[model samples]
Target: MSAELDLSPEVPEPTLLESLLYNGFFLGAIVQLLCILAVIKPTSNWYEQV
Candidate 1:
């Protein structure tokens, strides 16, 4: 029973290119969100300006 339980399939680690692509995607998403916020923020203060 213990041996059976220990027979779970091993997960493969990510390769270097895969790691870089994942990190790049995450950073790109963050930067896109910040750019969107920057664009919306000025418009959001339109009432104050008026």
Candidate 2:
């Protein structure tokens, strides 16, 4: 019971490196999706530009 009541007040938050890593992976997924779409439809201007 004492241990449960003694929890630290500090809350875990994402660090800059963690945020960067998450965004990098997210961007990578979007790029991969675009590439796949481009393969399926080569004539679209958006796909061509990518």
Global lDDT scores for all candidate models: 0.88, 0.90
lDDT of 2 at 10: 92
Q: Which portions of model 1 miss their true places by more than 4 Å?
A: 1-5, 43-50
Please identify model 2 stretches exceeding 4 Å from their true place: 1-11, 44-50
TM-score of 2: 0.62
lDDT for position 38 in model 2: 84
- In model 2, state the lDDT of residue 15: 100
* RMSD (CA, angstroms), candidate 1: 4.5
Q: What is the Cα-based lDDT of residue 17 in candidate 2?
A: 100
lDDT tens readout by residue for model 1, 1-50: 45555668898999999999999999999999999998877656577887
Inter-residue clash pairs, candidate 1: none
Strongest candidate by lDDT: 2
